[model samples]
Target: MSTHDVKHRLRQLRGLPERVRALEAEVQENRQLNRRIAELTDIVTELLIPLEARDRDKVAEILERYKQGL
Candidate 1:
């Protein structure tokens, strides 16, 4: 390895910290999005319970409750 090669490698590594920080921020955003998706999925599943049971009144009740919660 020559001095010029070592200097080039050092310069390349200089930006690694910023790159890692950007990637970490992206990962955090993705996690939050995934969590929101899971919560919506849960709400959808709950809403489907009444449909599966074929109870219109229960479905209406559940929908009202969900609306109030939101």
Candidate 2:
């Protein structure tokens, strides 16, 4: 085979592992981000209301000052 043909075949066949590694890294990053979102959602949905209500006066005071600044 010609050098040119041999080089072309090698180039086409050599990139599989690198591409697979890149895709696996992205999948892991996405999984971590998804887990964080789930944790935050659970906090907001299941725990935030009573926690806020227990300190309703403080929350209202903070909101009043925040509104005044805005």
TM-score of each: 0.64, 0.52
Per-residue lDDT value at 17 in model 1: 99
> Which 10 successive residues of model 2 have the least lDDT summed?
42-51
Pairs of residues at least 3 apart in sequence or in different chains that clash in candidate 1: none
Candidate 2, residues 1-70, lDDT tens digits: the string is 9999999989877987898999999999998998899878866665555457668787677566555754
Error of 1 at 6 (Å): 1.2
lDDT of 1: 0.83
Q: What is the lDDT for 29 in model 2?
A: 94
lDDT of 2 at 22: 93
Alpha carbon lDDT of each predicted model: 0.83, 0.76
Deviation (Å) of 28 in candidate 2: 1.5
Per-residue lDDT tens digits for candidate 1, residues 1-70, read 9999999999889989999999999999998998899887977776666557667787788889877876
CA error at residue 16 for candidate 1, angstroms: 1.4
